[model samples]
Target: MTVLKAADELEEIVARVGPTAARLLTRGEEETMPEIAEALGMTEKAARARPTHYEHLDS
Candidate 1:
């Protein structure tokens, strides 16, 4: 998906889950995406496949 779409999705997730979603996105741990997805109740595929999707969270 495009960065725009990813950002939108990330924004929505953040809206639902609050700052923890952004914190997970910026985390430097191994398997961070999967951890973030699991924390947010999303599928691992949706998180791991598109790292840039959460760029807005970093900003």
Candidate 2:
């Protein structure tokens, strides 16, 4: 997915679930990767990479 789409999806997930859950989702553990990917219409790798992707957005 595009960087903007990834950032938007990550922002939505954080808004819905809070930063703690968002952080866990980015870890790609406990099946969170697939779930987050489906929820955000992104790939598992995109979901897994969101936290780091966000870091770059801020810089």
Q: For candidate 2, write residues 1-59 as lDDT tens digits.
A: 69999999988775555645555545657566687789989987887776665544332
User: How many clashes would you count in candidate 2?
Assistant: 0
What lDDT is reached at residue 6 by model 1?
95
Worst lDDT 10-window in candidate 1: 49-58
Pairs of residues at least 3 apart in sequence or in different chains that clash in candidate 1: none
Q: What is the lDDT of residue 38 in candidate 2?
A: 91
Those runs of model 1 whose alpha carbons end farther than 4 Å from true positions after fitting are 1-29, 56-59
Candidate closest to the true structure, highest TM-score: 2
Q: Report lDDT (CA) for all predictions.
A: 0.62, 0.67
Model 1 TM-score, all chains together: 0.32
